[model samples]
Target chain A: MKLTILGCYSATPRTDTNPTSQVLEINNHMFLIDCGEGTQVELRRNKIKFARIKHIFISHLHGDHFFGLVGLISTFRLLTRETELHIYCPKGLKEVITLQMKLADSWTNYQLIFHELTSTESELIFEDDKVQVFTIPLDHRVYTNGFLFKEKAGDRHLDMDAVLNANINVAYYRKLKQGYDVVNEDGVLIDNNKVTTDPNPPKSYAFCSDTAYNEAIIPIIKGVDVLYHESTFLDQHASLAPKTKHSTAKEAATIAKKAKVKTLVLGHFSTRYDNLNDFKSEAQTVFESVELADDGKTFNFD
Target chain B: MKLTILGCYSATPRTDTNPTSQVLEINNHMFLIDCGEGTQVELRRNKIKFARIKHIFISHLHGDHFFGLVGLISTFRLLTRETELHIYCPKGLKEVITLQMKLADSWTNYQLIFHELTSTESELIFEDDKVQVFTIPLDHRVYTNGFLFKEKAGDRHLDMDAVLNANINVAYYRKLKQGYDVVNEDGVLIDNNKVTTDPNPPKSYAFCSDTAYNEAIIPIIKGVDVLYHESTFLDQHASLAPKTKHSTAKEAATIAKKAKVKTLVLGHFSTRYDNLNDFKSEAQTVFESVELADDGKTFNFD
Candidate 1:
């Protein structure tokens, strides 16, 4: 799995830093997170294939979080895309987007579907053969939710030589790979553990942003491999963070530590400070494995 | 009066060429016309003082025409503007901007006024002491209207020598400048025309974009000093012009000729043509004074 940081600023888009948005790639799927203003331009700059993006998750209704969404959708229509497009966002998004489309009398030819997420619970929103997506309810000023992407454990690795030495039928190799023991034609029993190795452990990633420090989401992202949390402010601005329902770097690190995530990626730095080294250093104090997210940096999980 | 072509290339916003948008300065007022995507960055690139812009005019509801409006508005709010903002757009624009504001819960301290236009006939939408703005009803798929900004004829310019020779009192100097000649202290009668001349001919500029080659607006914008018209396609795509409700360079020049506009500035070129010499040559066939609008090029009428 690989994740790319397209934009990670807070409050507004500046000449230097952008607002909240990122792209997470799990196997063959490309999922867009947050989608702030100017995201399409950033996507083009990063050389990401925007058409390959099939799913988009919007954390909240903030303009910095999803203002470029209308433009992106309009561009997709102009490109003559026929593939189905899925947008997971709050309920009022349909009214906002559809109104513009109605006024312009332009409609997309593709299957533009909206999976409205209003429930404040860990409900599974998407599931496929290899991946599953669940909502991690968060505390914020508005209707906001985080996403947890988990890759399901796959089939076991089979030792073909061991299976053949046990006199098992060649047709039963598929069953052994599925962690099942098979009986041989010679009335010999083959042990599954002897022939098959355990499956690779599944990896998971969780995304949280534009929300205050909340421990309620910890249970949903308990065993995540990597958690990207928004650190809009530092400890010095902690007073303003709660009033605005945004988290500071130290608060984000504390949440990540309490969630017991393997690693933490901090982003969404406020524009007040020119330097960002303080954010990384503050988060690293609580979370041992912490990295600051940049505009175009890509992270790979092995 | 001066006009600056910020961007004019049609279709999607590429790295080199931008979509439709421009800036016009008339009588000490900066008017932002049609904010395409990345317009603020373009404004910064051109070194145009954004704070001087108190009015923004959107031609239509097309994505390329006003996709950058929201971002520009947000940036102004971030800058903590104390000046009131006025947007003259289609009727549906209020809902779109208000919805985004509602979601973010960030209202501007300065008053934001929206003058929605829905008329099919020409009508004055804005008028100050020096300039008047009128909407030229357009024929398109959506509710569209072009703007005609005309610097109202001011009081006659006072010829200093003529005024001194007429022996007009200093208190009546204002009245003399307004072309009302008064009797001198010597009881000599002075003609108003002899004392003053026309006030710089009152320059005018008309911005017509994203519309077909309709002759109805010719009478509305007749005898304008400079006319910035959209020429989305060349003569080769003339057949697509009327059908799409767009214009060719030749068509725009023809309209300029019919309206007797002083100078014609052709812009909003289609992205299909690599070379723009054909548009200039085609427009020259119908109008003698014609120039292609290049991004960042400024035209001064003095």
Candidate 2:
């Protein structure tokens, strides 16, 4: 799995810092998250192909979270894209985007699908043979949701020498990989474990942003291989966190620690802070494994 | 008058080249025109303060022309701006912008007034004591209008030496500046022309973009001091101009020459051409004085 941070700063986009937007590549799917203003330029700067973004997920209706969405859709139309695009966002976002398109009189030639999320409980939103996506309801000033992407385990690997020694027929190989015992060519029943080994362990990633300190999400994101949480403020501005419905570095670290995530990535930093290292140090005081997210940064997980 | 080009390229914005957006400063007023995506960041990069801009003029509803407007308004709200902002745009933009704000529940603290233009004829849209802005209707794929900003002629210069020689009283100086014949202290009538010269010829700038090769706007923009016109194509792609409702470089110069504009500035070049100098050479074939618009380039007219 590979994750690329197109932008990580908070509030309005500036010349040096961008707002919240990122790309996650998992199991041949490239998912765009929280496209803030200037996100298209950032994507171009990062050399990410626009054709690869088939699905986009918006956390909320905040301007900093999803203002770039319409521009991106318009660009897709200008490029004459033929691939269908899917958008998963809050219920009201569809109206906002469709209205803009209606005014421009520039409708997309490709199919545009919107998946509005209104459920307050954690539920599976998407599932395929190799991947599953679930929504983690978050507490914010508006209706918001974070997404959790998990990879499904693959089929067991066949022990070729052991299978040949057991005189297993070629047709039975498929059932053996499915962890099923089958009769060999000699008409003898064979154990599945003796001919195949276990598959690699699956990995999971959780993304949460623009939310207050809430323990309710800890269980939903528990034991995630990587957890990206928003830390908009540091310790000095801790008082503003609750008032603004944002999280401080220490609060994000506490959630990361409680969830027992293998790696914690901190992002969505407020532009007021001059030093990003301060957030890293503050988060590390509570959580041992903490990483800072900056614009154009990339992380790879095996 | 000082004009700053924030973005001048056509089509979608890229990492190095931006779409259409510019800042025009005339007679102490800063006017933002055609805010494409990433315009707010471009404004910051150019060091133009947000508070100085009270008016925005959008030529059309195309995504490259006005997509950044809502984000800029939302940023103003985040900045706690209390100054009123006025927007002049096509008829459908108000509904499109207000709906996004309503969905996000993020209304601006400042008053946002919209002046929807639907006239096919040239009309005055804004005027104050020192400046007047008129719409130069143009033909495009959508309803479009260019803006003509003309600085109202200032009061005639005092010509202090001539006034004092005529023994004019301090109380009559205001009348003298208004080009009135005023009685001097000795009760003698003094001629206005003898005391004062004509104020610097009122400068005018016409901005026409995203339009076809229509001669209807020639009369409205005739004899303007500077004219910024869209040249989306080169001579090689002249055939695509009418089909796309865009203008070629030579076509733009032809309009400039026929209108007798002092200087013609070509912008909105298609990204396919790598050399911008070719546009300048192509335009010079029809008009003697021509300039190319580039991102971050500024032009000052005295």
What is each candidate's DockQ, to 2 decimals? 0.54, 0.85
lDDT of 1 by residue, A1-302 (tens): 89999899876675567788899999678999988777887888888887899999998887788987988898889889889999999888988889889888899999999999889888999999889999988888888999999998888998878877788888998898788878987987787999889988888999998789998988999979999999999899899988989999999999989999999999988889888899999888888889889888899987
Scanning candidate 1 chain B in windows of ten residues, the lowest lDDT window is B10-19
How much does candidate 2 score in TM-score?
Answer: 0.98
lDDT of 1 by residue, B221-290 (tens): 8999998899999877899999989999989998999999999999998888999888989999889999
Best by lDDT: 2
True contacts kept of 2: 0.84
**lDDT string, candidate 2, B158-194, tens digits:** 8989988999999998888888999988889999999
RMSD of 2: 1.3
Top candidate by TM-score: 2
- Model 1 segments more than 4 A misplaced: A160-170, A184-187, B161-167, B185-187, B192-197
Residue B74's C-alpha lDDT in candidate 2? 93
> What's the TM-score of each model vs. the native?
0.94, 0.98
